[model samples]
Target: MKAVILAGGEGCRLRPLTNHCPKPMVPILNKPVMEYSIELLKRHGITDIIMTVHYLSSSIRSHFGDGSKWGVTITYSEDGMPLGTAGSVKLAEQMLTESFLVISGDILTDFDLSAGIQHHEDQLAAATIFTKPLDLPIEYGVLLSADKKMDKMFEKPNWSDLTKHSINTGIYILDPKIFTYLEDFTHYDFSKDVFPAILKHNEKISIFEAEGYWSDIGTLATYREAQFDMLHHKVNLPSKGKEIAKGIWMEDGVTIHDDVTLKGPIYISRNTIIHEGAIVGPQTVLSESAIIHEKSEITHSILWENSYVGKSCSLGGMIGHCQIQDHSALADMNDETVNAWREYTKRDS
Candidate 1:
């Protein structure tokens, strides 16, 4: 029972691509949206991670450093500033000594979380929040609960503080005395200051709800609708590349050129290149060494790593990290390339 992953904000609505990527290394399908919350907390076995990191904390410590390629054992609480969401879990409260799990590395949930930590140790809960049912909880903060404990909390709540629709999927399961309601340098806020100061001291916090599929990449229009809801599989990730036909995902040094006109839910990473008379995708994403030269025409795009789409560029949007050329479309490119891309950054997160 150990996981922290708050990954400190600074996504700033994904501006200029977080001005060099650090909204937990954004890029949904080609991986790294906090690597799907570290493979959903290593599929609930919870490999002892911590990861608090502020702003551009060296690109998330040079890409999950001690996480040992995802078997997980990372630590790094590094926030020298901007600590809000419960003051960044009270700055990892001395490694959260007991039952811990507080997610949000730019969210995208699968959420079983070991049945919400076995219903927070069979309701002997000290802290546990994880809720769902949000048909516009109206910009969040709802949670009411009854037998599962959490009595009331309403912040933007209305419709008479809801008879049903809850919110707060900022996931949690604390209890290391829940850090005694936090106060290290104060900016506490587990829903605007530690669950209303733990229900104003009557204490008793648990509230589970949770089922599956939650999204919060935060802006860039919900990060382009969470990468088209992971190419419409609707989140149960792990499809990096290898489909090769039905939705066309191709990985190994890919390079298609016999008059290319492929389309599908498309993803073509790892040494990508598609030249002759190109007509890419229905929801394209081509990271890892990308380049589509000839008659270009990408649709519903995203092309990050080492991208280069120049020749005949009929490109759509969000074309790659840098160097793009113009053969047409994309608001016709020229006003000094729209003032050097004044932060549209070729569209979306």
Candidate 2:
């Protein structure tokens, strides 16, 4: 079956990182976030795919050209303007002739798409939405289903009005017939417009309660959480590099000097250098060619490609492609300088 990947979101919450790249292209464990979704689709035997792109579309296109590397045939549908979730898929209507699956590119999940497909076919429903129970439902569109049929839907409901914690996971098995509800070149979201209209017209909308790991890394907090989850093996994400030590994964050409302490659950990408007396780890990711100088300490942080942490520096949070000079701590950097560094990193990287 063909699948539609909505990869057009601007990812405003993930500011500095998203400033240089699209949300789908955001790196997690030295790999683009959307790459995991593509891998997941491949695992479920869904190879034919269409990706909808808008903001920084070229980045994604260049990264996964034709999806050949992943053993899948991928076609891209570019939107000249912001065409909301379902609207973006409508642009590629000709390519989706049969029943198709719709998923968000920014989300990471190991959900059983095959099982969800089977559920959709067995019910013969027009659309089947994958839903998961969330402890905090205020940020997501909540759904109330009875006997697998969606009874009511609420978009980002307030705490007082919340009736259920089951929220939309932005994964859908949609029959081509559902295309009749969408219009081309318009801003229309599935949750805000299409799905609610379907319920109003009394059309069949089934809900598949997902079982397995799923995370929508929309904000900085959740993004960090997703990294930690992968490190802890909460989700079965395939490791990219070789496992040099028990919990440390390192790519080829990585240089580590003696006296450098690396705690478990850390990933150092290709050609990265960790100098002597440097301490790094415990949920940290060093992207390709990153440099951690002597006596530097990085904990629970991410260093982007080619970023430099000078000697004796200490960093705890996200560090994009920028240089932190010797004897400096992240806390010591002024807001203006940090902003300038972020801008410079975006431009240079």
Candidate 3:
């Protein structure tokens, strides 16, 4: 079977971090977020992939190359223009001559794709969407289905009816015939355009409620939460690093001073250094080559690759590529903080 990974979204909500890197390249546990999606596809025995790339497309191409390392053959559909979701895949319509699954490269999930494909095949529908039931379906749209057939999609409907349905996961299995609904190489979204057109024509559209961990990581908060989820074993991925102790993971070349406080549920990636008197608190993630100076305290925060925290500094929230000064503190992160960081980065570079 084949798959189309939608890797083109720029992730406007996850700015500051997404400023320099593509959404798919966003690091999760020191690994590219899209890499987990590739690993998931490999586990389901779907090795042939076509990734639709835009917005720092080179980062993806340079990192994965031909995808041989993951045992998948990847061919990119590089978009010269911003071809939304459906249009991006439409660019590679010729390559998808048969049934194919479409998933967001930035999303992290351990869903059973094979089972979802089997459901789609059994139904022989025009398309099958993968969905997950939210514990509190407050913000997401509700896709109501009857006997596995899509009934109606409501945007932020009354919560009284929320428990009866599942939210769309932006994962789908589609027949090649569905391409007829999409215009050639034009920008279109599956939810806003193509699917509505299919529904207008009374074509078959099915929904499969998947059972597993699924996170879109749309915001900076969710991005950190997803990594914390991994630390807590909420989701299982064959991730990097070794768990040296309960809830504590360290990768190669990690150097920690004996006087430093090592907290559980913390992940220190390759070549990270923690100096004397530093407190590596719970839910702290230090990416590759990140350095924590003496007596610095990092709690519930994330430091991207090579970011440095100066002596006695205290921090929280996401820190992008940075060299924070000694005794500096940033406890709350908002849009203003993000813009300031971006400007700081611009000047620092």
Candidate 4:
């Protein structure tokens, strides 16, 4: 079966990071988010795949060329214009001119696609929207179903709608004919435009509800959380971090000087250095080429590539992302810096 993966968004919310890398290319435990989606599709016998590309499309094409490595034949649907979710799927109609599954590139889930497809077939619906139950459905679309059949979809609900709610998982088994609803020369969001039109025509838009792990790596906090989830084996991956010791994963070419202290759950990426007397991690991630000077202490933080932590500095909930001119210091700061009561002043300025 063919599958359409929407990987076209600019990922505006994850700026600074997304400024350098595409959202789907952002690493979750050192693996691109799109890799997980592709693996899941390949595992479920969906061999032919079409990626709808826009911003930074070349990076995606370069990384997952031909999909032969993962036992799938991949195609690209490069969108020359900004197409919304439904529009992107519609734009890929030529590739998916048959029954196909559609999923977002940035969403992380272990949802049962096979079962959803089966359910779609059983109902003979034009579209089968995968539904997930959220704690607060106020910000999401509420799928109303009775007797296991989706009757209607109401988006951005109030308290009343929250009582009988199921939310769109952004995964769908869509019939190619649904492409007819997509109008030309406009941005058409799936939830706002297409699904509503389908319901108005009393078309069967079935719901395939799955109770499984689902996460959207949309922000830095959620992205970090996804990494932790992967480390704990909540989401299975081929390699669950490299083992430098019994319970440590130090990246290749990392330099750890003598007398440095480290606790478990540390992931030091390639070319990072921990100088003498530096204390690092009980839970920390040092990105590639990071440097920790003597006696500097770090915990519960994520240092981006090429960062440096100065001597005697303390960090908690920090994110250091780059180096300063002349390599004399790092552009480092922390939650402590943001807290006004700490009375800490910026000396680098």
Candidate 5:
């Protein structure tokens, strides 16, 4: 079966991080977020895939060219302008001749797609929308059903107005004929326009309640939660690197001097170095080639590739490629210096 990955979102909520990388390319556990999506699709035996790209299209194209590295054939549909979710998939209508699956690229989930497909086929519905129960439904589009039929759909409704906690997971098994409802080069979203229109016409749309982990990493808070979830094994993501010590994973060429303390549940990527007297960890991630100087301390933080923490510096929270001077905290760094650091750490790839 063909799969359509909606990867074109600008990710305005995840600023700074998304400033350099596309939303799909955002790092979770030192791996691009979409990489996990591709792996998940492959695990379900769905190899023929189409990815829709808009912002930083070339970067995504370059990173996973032809998808051969992942043992899948990848076709890209680039948008000249921002096409809404459904509109973007419409651009690839020719490739999606059969029933297909649609999923957001920015989300991190291990939802059983195979089961979802089975449910879709058994019901013989025109479209099947994967639904999950959310404790807080205000931020998502709520799906209301009665007698096994969709009755109402509300997008980001107030708490007082909510009747159902089941929300759309942005994963769908769609019939190709659904393309007929969308126009080319126009902005149209599945939740805001297409799905509602289908319900209005009394078309059969199945709703499958997802059973496994699902997280839409749309904001920094969710991103951090996803990381912690992975650390706790709440989600079944591939191991980031070699587990050299208990709760501490490190890649090849990692250098650590004596007297450096590394707490558990941390990932140190390739070629990173922790100098003497440095204390790292307890839910921290150091990206490739990061340098933690002598006596520096980092806890509950994520450091991007080639980041430098000077001697005696203390850092917590999300930090990119910025360099912290000796004895300096993150707040001591100015915006100009941070921008310069980001530019310096920019990857040519």
Candidate 6:
């Protein structure tokens, strides 16, 4: 079966990182989120895919060209204008000749796609949405279902009903016939427009409750938490237990000096260098070719590829590409000293 991955979102929430790169290209544990989705689809024997592209389309095409690297064939639906979720699918109607699945590129999950498709086929519904239960339905809209079949969708209800049912997980097994309900290249949203229209027409739409690890890493906190989850084996990712040191994992050709101190749960990509007296770690990621200068400290941050951390520096709560000025230092370095230190201080002074 072919699958359509909705990768056209602007990803306004993950700014600066998504400023240059597309949302699907954003790395989760040094691997693109879109790659994980592709791997999952390939596992289910869905080798043909149509990825809807808008922002930084070339980057995505360049990264996953031909899909042969991942044992799949990828065709892109390059949107000239910003098309809504359903509209994007409508734009690729010609490619989706049979029943297919539509999933968000930004979401990360190991939901049973085989079961979802099976459920869709068994029920013979026009569309089958993958749903999961959430503790806090207020944070997300509650999908009302009866006897394992979706009845209505209530968006963010005011009162908390104990019988609060499932929520849409943004994964759907859709029959090609559903495309007839969508308009091309228009601002037609799947949730707001298409689904509601389908409901009005009294068409068969079902929901399948997923049972497995699932997460939507939409915020900074959730993104950081996903890294921790991968470390703890709560989620299955490629880099889960690849740690070389106690909390550090170095790729091939990484060089670290004896004077360099690395804390646990840090990942340094291939060819990264740690200079003398540099302290890296406590949950940090130094991408390829990143240079850690002498006496520098980094904690709870992610430095993009080829960034340079200056000498005598401390970087905390940071992210993405940068070049630190030489001789810069963070204030909380000297625990014994209760006063602030100069930003640029000489070693002899």
**lDDT measured at residue 288 in model 3 versus the true structure, 0 to 100:** 96
Better of 3 and 6 by lDDT: 3
Candidate lDDT values, in order: 0.78, 0.86, 0.86, 0.76, 0.85, 0.78
lDDT pick, better of 1 and 6: 6
C-alpha root-mean-square deviation, candidate 2: 5.8
Candidate 4 stretches greater than 4 Å from native: 240-257, 270-273, 288-294, 305-313, 324-349
Off by over 4 Å in 3: 155-163, 333-349
lDDT, candidate 1, 1-349, per-residue tens: 8888888888776687787677888887778888888887887789888888878788788877898887979888877888687787787787777878888888888879999899989987778899999777766778878887888878777687688788888888878876787878667778877777777877778899988899888766567667666765677877577775777777888888888898877788888888888899766788888888889888766778887878887765454474668585563344543343343333423
TM-score-better candidate, 1 vs 4: 4
The runs of at least 3 residues in candidate 5 whose Cα sits more than 4 Å from the true structure, single-residue gaps closed, are 242-246, 331-349
- Model 3: per-residue Cα lDDT over 1-349, one tens digit each: 8999999889899987888899999999999999999999999999999999999999899999999999999999999999888999999999999999999988899999999999999998999999898866666667888888987776667877664758988999998887898788688988878888888999999999899999987877568768877877778787788888998988989899879998877899988999999998666789999999999988767788999989999886555676889998867667764554454335434
Error of 5 at 143 (Å): 0.8
In model 2, the clashing pairs are none
**Higher-TM-score candidate of 1 and 3:** 3
**Model 4 Cα lDDT, one tens digit per residue, 1-349:** 7899999998887777788677888766556788999988987888889999999999999999999988999999988888898887777676777788989999888887889888889999988889888876676678888876777677787787555768888898888777788876568988888878887877778888887777877766566566655555566545434776744777678899999998756678888888889888755778777888888877766777678777777776555374422223332345532342122112111
Q: Rank the candidates by TM-score, best first.
A: 2, 5, 3, 6, 4, 1
Weakest 10 consecutive residues of candidate 5 by summed lDDT: 340-349
Residue 62 lDDT in candidate 2:
94
Model 4 CA RMSD to the hidden true structure, in angstroms:
5.7
Better of 2 and 6 by TM-score: 2
Q: lDDT (0-100) at residue 151 of candidate 2? A: 86
Alpha-carbon RMSD, each predicted model: 16.5, 5.8, 5.8, 5.7, 6.2, 6.8
> 325, model 6: CA deviation in Å?
2.3
Per-residue lDDT of candidate 5, residues 114-216 (tens digit): 9999999998888999999998878899999875556778889888878889999999999987887888889999988898778766778998988989999
Give the lDDT of residue 240 in candidate 6: 26
Clashes of each: 0, 0, 0, 0, 0, 2
lDDT of 6 by residue, 177-246 (tens): 8777776668787777777887787888888888887777676555655655565556654662266655
Model 4 TM-score is 0.83
